[model samples]
Target chain A: MSTLTPTVPAKPARGLRSTEGKAPRAQRESPFARVSAMIVMGVFTLYFLVPIWWLLVAASKNRSQFNSTNPLWFADFSLFENMGNLIAYRDGVYLKWMLNSAVYAGGGALVGTIIAGMCGYALAKYNFPGRELIFNVVLGGVLVPATALALPLFLIFSQISLTNTFWSVFLPSLVSPFGVYLARIYASASVPDELIEAARLDGAGELRTFFTVSVRMMVPALVTVFLFQFVAIWNNFFLPLIMLRDETLFPVTLGLYAWNSQVNQIPVLRDYVLIGALLSIIPLIIIFLLLQRFWRNGLSAGSVK
Target chain B: MQIKKRAAAVALLTAATVVLTGCASGSTTSGGDAAACEPSEGKVDLTFTTWIPGMEDVAAVWNEENPDVQVKVQTGPNGNGGTYQNFFNQLKAGNAPDLGQIEYDALPNFRVQDGLMDLAACEGVLDAKADFVDWTWGQVNFGEEDAVYAVPQDAGPMAMFYRADLFAANNIAIPTTWEEFAVAAEAVRATGGYITNFSQSDINQFAGFVWQAGGSWFENDGENWTIDLASPESVKVADYWQDLIDRDLVSTNPPWTDEWNNAYNTGSNWTWNSAAWGANSIASGAPDTSGNWSVALSPQWAAGDNAAGNWGGSSTAVFKGSKHPYEAAQFALWLNTSDEALTMLNKSANLYPAAKSGLELPALKEGVEFYGGQAIYDVFAEASDHVSPDFIWGPTMTQVYNDTSDGFKGAVTGNGTLTDALTSAQQSTIDALEAQSIPVNK
Candidate 1:
């Protein structure tokens, strides 16, 4: 595990230099290849970023200007006004959706990560009968899509009279098999047996050793798991769509979708949907940027092993 | 580790079994028998789900006045987007809202599924029948004896919204008949503008066209459903539009899209034949053209004819399992029939109320600034009066709309004619009805 730590920092720098160094060689070998690569990357970058740019521009325009003015450019700087209207519309329901999204994503991810972490650590540290069977099941769970489970989950929740409650959506979100798989892989690769034995030799309980000693070593993995689960839960629409009928409990994704559908009836909601969509993705971008270093490290760590 | 693995495995296995069993046992509960519509004892709380804009404010008014029967309003997407699907799921789960906003075309679907309460037994429900327009009243009853399934909420009487300035500037006379409308389309195209943008996805609009032509797409004779999607009258209407599309006299932009809005806003499209609610659609979609628009009666198939089509309208229905049907019916009647509530709804959602008295509201009389100071609702009122009361909706309107819309999209792209779309859609509608176990005439 100690030997693994040094390679994490050194590998990124070497990787960065290797990419940078390839640029010169690429130019020297064939300008056409270099130019083509740059062109391809440029096209992909535009393909990915242009819709976001259009959303930003559209969110800044009033309803009149949305169709009358340039679609890809701003006019009259009505972003604040549009945002105020969106916030004030339906008595600040947009903000409620934003808050609900935070609770579902933030709360769901944190709790889901811990459960996944503990379960993964146990599988990695323990020599258990049926461990492979359990891991295989977890792997199978990862293969099952969330959309496929939404209807059955609705039925199960409905049987207990939990449909339309916050718990109906939150409870289903907690079981992230992908997070469990990631945690196990990272735990086995990074958390050494010697360190656990050493911690145990000091009379530490298994839980204490796992939390204090092993968890410190698993920061990158846990952060990756948290961010993954957060984004997944944040973007989840079908589960909440079926599980909850209460608009106040809706996540921003479902809320925006509802508004988008009503634009024909409430045409002004078009502007609100545009601005809401732009605002919805801001938190995702912020979270990604904040946890990017750990995410990158976690990805590299898994790949190297 | 062995204990933890066993624990995790047990948890996973249990969850999987529960889900599997849940799926296997997800048999739908048959709708309850007609309940005695009795007032609940003590204070009653009810849930009403609707997608209407400003419905919260309207419900708040109701809640303030009637504390004993407080309503919790949940707003979502329009019916057919996701809300209808949610309603069906909630109905299966036995947790549907006490009342839900169901469109007229969709009411039969819910009725066939046995999801609605027979409000005729409710206090004052049948008595309130005189409050709504005749057609709207008939819509709620589905021509059934002593069974009012819903209270009509709004009506969408069809009319033509045109650019007065564009028509004037080009020295083109506004068309009053279908033949003249065709000629006007040619003239408008000569001026480098489409007479109207034909919607490729809004099969409901196409249905409205057929409705105005004195054609009925569905008829239920109390035993079997009859689907006449390609009846001669319907084919005549379709061929007329098909000619406009073929000759490029109309732009085939998909409705509710930016391109469609741009066509209206930029005056590349000169007219739209839409429902009463479409006034707001034009005002919001083409703000730049606000002061230049005017409303006229929808063009006649024969000159001097007064037939008008109806498009979108909805009803407030008490679900089958609602405990407070008595209170639900009272609220629904008040919401639809009362002048105060109707005016509020008109201002909030541009709702053309199904109540006959709603046509005479002060708001309906005033000249709207957006439509060149025209008293547009006057036109809609006349259209509402002319809307045929016999246009029966089938039990699978969603399926019909979807199948027809897909075919219409193909027609617009030259894959087929509009009549061909109607023909295929006719077969599809029958198939859908038969698949749903609803008896259908071939």
Candidate 2:
């Protein structure tokens, strides 16, 4: 612990020097290579951002303006009015869906992170039988897609009489194999064996040592795990589509999809769908911007070690 | 000892699976029995699923009036989009809602699946049959003696919605016959516009044309089914549309898309030969083009003919597993036949009621400002009266529509003619019926 404390202060100077040394090398590269890289990045950035820009512009227009006006530019800034209509539509059902999404994604990610942390911690520290086999199985789980599991999950949920309930979606979302994999790798790399021995020598229990010391060091990795699971569960569509029947129980993704499908029958819903889609992504953007520092640290931690 | 305990737990799980399977199979068979239509002993709470906008308000009105029979409304996507698939899954899970909005063409599918309750035994169901239009009643009855599968909610009688301002400006006359319509199509093309946009995915609109040509696509005797999608009248209708597409007089933009809406809003399309409900579609889809449209009778096959066709209409049916069939039947009847409910539905969703008295509602009599202040419902009223009552829908209309839509898309891309599409769709429809164990004449 004393050795780690001194290195933490020295690490920043080393990082600064490394970047300072590379600055001249970057300038010495050929201008054509730099120009080509910039061009490629600029084209890809435009390709990705153009649709979002269109959505923002369309969300500000009314139904008539949407059809007659330019699609890529703003006609009138009715975004606040559209937001008011979206919130007040159908007795504020949009707010209810938003609350449901918060519960499903927020709650699912929190519990999932804890479970994956514990499972990964055990795999890294314990010398028990079948530890390698268990990790192998989780690796296999990471390879399987969520869509393939949805039908089987629905069948099991129906047999147990849990379909159409919150648990049907939340329960399946709680299992994040990628989170487990990340936690295991980080736990092995960052959690020191000497610290565990010292804590044990001080008469602390294994669980207490883990909760107090290991979890503190694993913060960056846990935050990374939480955000990944958060985005995955937030954008999930198929599971909730099949599990839930009531509109009030639907997450925002499913609710927006339902409204979009009805635009043909009810044309005014088209604007609502566009505005709802724009609002639904705000949380994801906010989350990424908020936890960006921790995510970056988590990604580079294993490489640094 | 660990092995013994694990074996015991596995045995218990196997037993539970067997019991659940038994219960699931048992419920499905009992769901089909019509003898379970007795009224419940206490207050009933029924769930009714539909896609109609503002249906919650209608149900709220009923809830205020009838405390003993309360309805919980659930809104979803339109029937063919996703709601029907949900209904099937819910039925299999034994938790389907008591009442659902089913289109007239889809009612046959529900009936053949044994998913609908025969409402004939419920109170006032048989006596209330006279309140609805004859064809709508026939749609629910399916020529059966003592069976009423659903209560007809709305009817979609077809007519022409034209841009009166555009026609007058182009010095072209409103077409009254098919031949005149084709000639006007040429004129509209010459003026850098299309007569109308041909919908490649919405096959129901094409079926309306065939219906106006006095063609029947399917006929079901008590024992078996007959498929005739390529009849002479149908082929004639198909060939007529083929010529228009070949000449590039009509655009083939997909329906309900932003491009399709923009074409109408910009006056690039001059007419839409759609059902009565299309008035709202145009009004909302092309809000800038309001007050310039007018409704007329659908173009006739011959001069001075008084025939119309039906397109999209729906019924409210009580599912077979509902425990409160009597309460569900009462609510369904009131929602469709009552004057206040019908008027509210028309105002909210622009639904054309299936009841005969609904046509006389003051709301239906007034001129719509979007349609140049014309009383367009008058045209639809006449069209409703002239629709042939003998047009029958088959038990697999969804499958038939899907097959025909795929073929139509191919035809639009110049892979085949419309008649060829129909001929191939006819064969696939027969094959689908056979796969479902339905006896079909090849």
Candidate 3:
């Protein structure tokens, strides 16, 4: 396996024209091609960003101003006040949900990533009887939707007295077959067998050689797997909704959903729900942006192999 | 060496999944013999799930009064179909709350699942039965055996909440009859406004109109159900609203949503034919319209016909899961009949009371500032009396409500006439009932 050169160029606008300029004269495209592409990209960016922009603005408005004022822009600058109320509501229940979410997503993704990475690395770098069979099974697990598993998983957890606890959600979320598949492909591409042999020759234990040499090469793949599992665990609603009853154990997404259901009865909670939605995404955005460098390399590496 | 580890991990993964998936337990609460309530140490911890706003305070009163049984109030989804779905899910999981807040319309759906306990067996529940309104009493005493499935909590007897300022500005006299309402609808449209937002999605709203027009949809003698959904009275109700839809005098937005909020916020729909709870819901959605709104008795079929309809209200029902039926029924009765509980419920929930006692509560008597300081509940109180008793819902009210709502969608979108929708909805109801082996008298 070899490194896959990233298909998305460093600058698409420049790359499209520069790559084309090298071709024959008759094949040359119109001058407006790049401009039109840029326009299309700009329109898509706006289309995607506008709702988030509106949410950010909506979070700042009070209950009265939410519907009465301009929808896409800020009015009363009540973001702080609303956030304060959201935190203070039901005696800081929102913060508890946020903590629960952090525990479920962060801890689950970390554990899932380690297992997935190790498993993927083994599948990609090693060959044994029934290897393809195992790979195919893991791929099948990836295709079986999480929602379909939620109730059955709940019943399983209930039998074991874990349904209402954090473990119910955390345990199911930790099995990321897709994560393992990514790790396997990434490991084959990045971590050379020769490096492992060299480490082995130095008399390093199998575990030691794998940790010191292979794990370092697998960092980008591991982070991508972790982020994938993290977002899935964070946004998970049905699993938590069906499994947990104690409000104290709820994730932010489920908590917001519960609040939103009562919005018509308590209109004031609408502001809190909007603000909570805005704030819940900020952490995910920050994490994604922070790890994007690793993600790009890992994605390209996976594709190339 | 790595090959061995790969094979080991795959085997382990497969083994783990097998164990996890294999652990799928038996279907929840399969044996009908859920053990009778054994109050340990004469103290039972009960979980009551409800969507009623301010239910916690009522629970607190129950807790304070009865130290022997601790009540934990869990919030369920709102009464608009979500609560029923949640109830069904919990019931399936065999972990439903001991007491579930069920709507009069949705009660039968839970009953059909054998999820509810017959309250007749619970001590003292029958004595407290006389405390609720006659119509509300009829709702609880469901099925052919005349069994009480639930105790009424709050009600939503319908009324026309009008914008007095808009009507006065237009020189439109208060509409006392359906013809006058149509005239006012046209007057409002003349001013580039709508009289009301006829939500194609709110089946409860349409049902309320039918109730006022003297249509039951279903009737039972504790044995066989007679479903007459397309009764002439109901057809008349549908035709009247259909005429309004054709005239474009009403906006066909879905209710209790952002789009409907926008219509009210902009004064597009100057009137609301809603339940007593509409005042609180309106206060939440369009607080700026306060002091401009007022309540009138819902417009009539005939000039002197004083019948009314109900849209949303719920009852506290004892699930078959209750370990202590006596205590559960006691809690349900107290939540409805206790003076402290009733006052707190009305104050916090803003639900029109199904209990006759709630009509006299000071909290309910207070003028709602949102309706321009009108004691608007008086109209709803009168409307509650007018709510035609003996109007029984079929076991498939949820499916029927949805089917009828879909009909409204057809009418609104020009795919079918309102009369066609009624005919289709009635046929669907009869077909669905017959499929379920319930008797359907078309």
Reference-based TM-score of each model: 0.91, 0.88, 0.88
DockQ of all predictions against the true structure, Cα-based: 0.53, 0.44, 0.29
Let me know the TM-score candidate 1 reaches against the reference structure: 0.91
Q: Check candidate 3 and list the clashing pairs.
A: B37-B323, B144-B222, B144-B223
Worst 10 residues of 2 chain B by lDDT: B13-22
Task: Identify the superior model by DockQ, candidate 2 or candidate 3.
Answer: 2
Clashing pairs in 2: none
User: Which of the two candidates, 1 or 2, achieves a greater lDDT against the reference?
Assistant: 1
Cα lDDT tens digits, model 1, B190-291, are 988899988888888888999999998988765567899999989999999999999999999988888999999999999999999989989999998879
How well does candidate 3 score on lDDT at residue B367? 89
Interface CA RMSD, all predictions? 1.4, 2.0, 2.8
| Model 1 bad stretches (over 4 Å) | A1-35, A303-305, B1-35
Candidate 3 reaches a DockQ of 0.29
Name the 10 consecutive residues with the lowest summed lDDT in model 2 chain A.
A1-10
| Candidate 2 second chain TM | 0.90
Clashes of each: 0, 0, 3
Q: Candidate 3 chain B, which ten residues in sequence have the lowest lDDT sum?
A: B24-33
| List of clashing residue pairs for candidate 1 | none
Give per-residue CA lDDT, model 2, range A95-129, as digits (tens).
Answer: 99989998999999999999999888889988999
Candidate 3 residue-wise lDDT, A1-305, digit = tens = 01223313436645576866676556554547645765677777788889999999989988777778888888979889889998988789789999999999999999999999889988988789999999999999989999888767866665676766778899898899998889999888888899998988899987887778899999999999999899999999988877766677889998888778877656667888899999999889989889988987888777777
